[model samples]
Target chain A: MGKHTVVPFGPQHPVLPEPIHLDLELDDEKVVRAIPSIGYIHRGLEKLVEKREFKEYVFIAERICGICAFGHGWGYCKSVEGLMNIEIPLRAKYLRTIWHELSRIHSHLLWLGLMADGMGFESLFMHSWRLREKVLDIFEKTTGGRVIFSACKIGGVRRDIEDSELHGIAEILRGMRDEVREITDIFFKEPTSVSRLKDVGILSKEAAVATCAVGPMVRASGIPLDYRVADTSGVYRELNFTPVTTDTCDCYGRCWVRVQEIFASLDMICQAIEKIPAGDIAVPVKGNPNGEYFARLEQPRGEAFYYVKGNNTTHLTRFRVRTPTNMNLPAMVEALKGCDYADVPMIVLTIDPCISCTER
Target chain B: MGYLSFAGTILGGLFKKPVTTQYPLKPAVLPEELRGRVLIDIQRCISCGMCMRKCPAGAIVVDRSAKSWSINRFACVQCATCVDNCPVKCLRMEPQYAAPGTVKQNETFVKQAAAQPAVAVTLVKGVTPTASAPATGTQAAAASAATAAKTAAAPQTTPPGDGAGHA
Candidate 1:
């Protein structure tokens, strides 16, 4: 009778935290084309760049995303340093790498928990979140905040890690990996999990690339475009970059890529810490920045984009951020094609969407 | 291999303790140097505006004339800028983390830090607190004399809040 039955997906849909909505056009219980609607949690973070001082903008930038505060701080610092042509100390660079990888592991752990819950795998969800608590405990003990860790500042990180802390990190990671691998193995082996995920919400490489899908989403489609491996910023040069992907391009594939990334992050962290150099944490940056610059870094979900322009004043002129979730929304819609109505939330959860980062 | 794996899984299940603590009863201790609770040693506070100027959260109000400082527990972020630059060393950062309310406007976490008691021992030349005071005072000053070095190394004293004492 009707051309299609349209269903509103989210903003308060149990799947995501930050608000994001999708109108699904369904034909006989099958999603044909999904239309994504965003911008619910936009706080005008970019606008603050014009009002706050350059050095202090790091604080605002760190709030761009809560789960990955270190990533935000590192990205903003990298951007400002790029404009000033200032080279951070080797020790600072290694510390940033360690922090970034640790954040990635936590991000993936959080996603795994959510994904498990999304597919009705409650035990796995509890297991992952519980394991993630250890990481947060480490964060609180090492850097301070459990969520928005205000650890990274303008030039370097706020604190230094001692040998005992590094040992603690490596030991915990080793133990956590075993539990994570067990859950992952069970996820792939269970028939119910397979029935829900294996072939659902597929996005081919062509659609993925054209839609500018990023992070594990693109990798799931068989595109090897990881910013860490392709990165020449020298911060990630010493650490190995092994891109992981599966050809299924389905929810399972995306989930698998993220799972594999946890292992990759562990390896990177272990290496970065061993090669750490000792020096002054923060370098002396005399004055404010005066120029226009855009910087990009890989977030746990995908590629996070940052843009800042200075008017030679205490405050910046214009600042804009295009988060990875925003870039992948169109592709997420495409991925939902041919997916069953019941699996919509699972498909969305697999993307690990942080709509706050997206809308910011 | 299957039997061995199952056995290992069973063993793992029995040995691992639950990661989370019993909430509301079993409280945890946060680490030192943590930017958790905002402290203000009111007596040592010099009414200096360094903290007020640097606070990104605008949570501190220094009323020099009133000889008083107040902080809005609801507005602080615990960023620790006040503690870092307190020239009189009055503001101290500690590991007291607890938000008592809801909404960004309702997160009440206020505390009062009294003025630090300074021991009035006689000042000695060429003698300093070992492993404490850096050479910044010596090398930086010896390199450039003639300027009064009276308050050269006094840590700035800032009073209460992470910066959000609105009243």
Candidate 2:
């Protein structure tokens, strides 16, 4: 056996978009064990609920992670609404689904770009991000903000997308499909790309279930668990969404699952726009919420958990978010073991860690 | 050998124009939903201070005495809560974003009425100017008692004339 050497990967690294430190125990060039230490970017966002009113806390929630901003805001509002027993209008639920699906597409595309960049495919990264800009343009034309769509409120949505605008969005997505498929086909079919990821970081179905992985991470491992498929909140069930899964349980499988899910998200958005019922976007939400409620949603990363406790006051007593990245950390550490040093970034990127969301 | 599959796309790109635009030289088209900056029409402002109160970032300051509204552009999050809550639709969100600057931009908009000559100000208590004598002690006491009784008897709805003082 070779002598072991320890190396600290990052509190800062080029491949990592957020700050996280990992200590890798290496025997020669293979990582025998990996230890992760977080909390570098913790901003105490959960504690801010004591100061900011519940209505305004949605803004803080949205700021949790730029990629999953809409999902965070919607999850927070859903928790508060559950606490207050407020049933939003049907149209608002449909609109929330449309925006949420759009956010999912953008986030997966962004991850695909970052993954390609991590694997030294700069041209693929550029193409992926270029296509992502069209989705951002759709967000701008509908919700006013590319990253933070301040549309979700406690009772319902803040604004409504007109039927004509919804059709315009569908046309844009349909037009972009061929380009997206062309770019992503390179990832799936290119021998070099497939070789780098095909068997790099294998997380078996048992290992994934044991680690309680969520999102594409678990789906790639052959478990058909998806928060959206089992969701009780929102109109995801009514829209007839299906979870994309594969049994390969490798880095490449994770990438494939995400790309397939992007197409699924596009179909869901088109379906939501088609079946959208016309009604008031929002009803007046009066009175302070008083109760404890736990809300969970399928974020682009995974299943995000939000718990809110209001004490009949404007300020919430406690607000907590269990981001998907946080839940997938154990799975990440498991996947990191027995991998070459060069594959570290690829394995980490497959998990799609949002350090800000986890630390916040 | 895997690179051969991408040859078609590479050749296609050779004929197509570059995707990126010369942003600095050519202005980009902005969407209507863009939340760029907050602007207020000073003429339509009622000095009610609702925008100041509702702002999550506390980036706005409304000084009724000065007849001025000011905002620190950098501090504004462009959430549009102020615009939605404004009693009159005077506040608007301009689609064009504020130009990036090294220095903080503080914009103070003065009401047109502020430039006019000083006139007799009306107080909610019906106080008026008297050159020779101030309000007599008896008259002040009577007015105070009447107001106190009216407040005690009524449910104390928001007074119409009281502006920033009550807030």
Question: Who wins the DockQ comparison?
Answer: 2
User: Can you write out model 2's per-residue Cα lDDT over A64-162, one digit (the tens) per residue?
Assistant: 899999999999999999999998999999998889889999999999999899989999999999999999999898889988889898889988899
Report lDDT (Cα) of residue A350, candidate 1.
Answer: 78
Q: Is the docking of candidate 1 incorrect, acceptable, medium or high quality?
A: acceptable
Worst 10 residues of 1 chain A by lDDT: A228-237
Give per-residue CA lDDT, model 1, range B1-167, as digits (tens).
75686898678878998656777678766677566777776655656567777787787777655546666666677777677777877877778764676554422222233323444444588886232333342122222231233223333312223133322
Clashing pairs in 2: A144-B33
The best candidate in terms of lDDT: 2
Q: For residues A243-287, could you state the per-residue lDDT of candidate 1 as single tens digits?
A: 888888888888889989999888878777777777866777766
Per-chain TM-score of chain A in candidate 2 equals 0.99
Q: Candidate 1: where are CA atoms >4 Å away?
A: A1-3, A232-234, B1-20, B98-167
TM-score of chain B of 1: 0.49
In order, the Cα lDDT scores of the candidates are: 0.76, 0.87
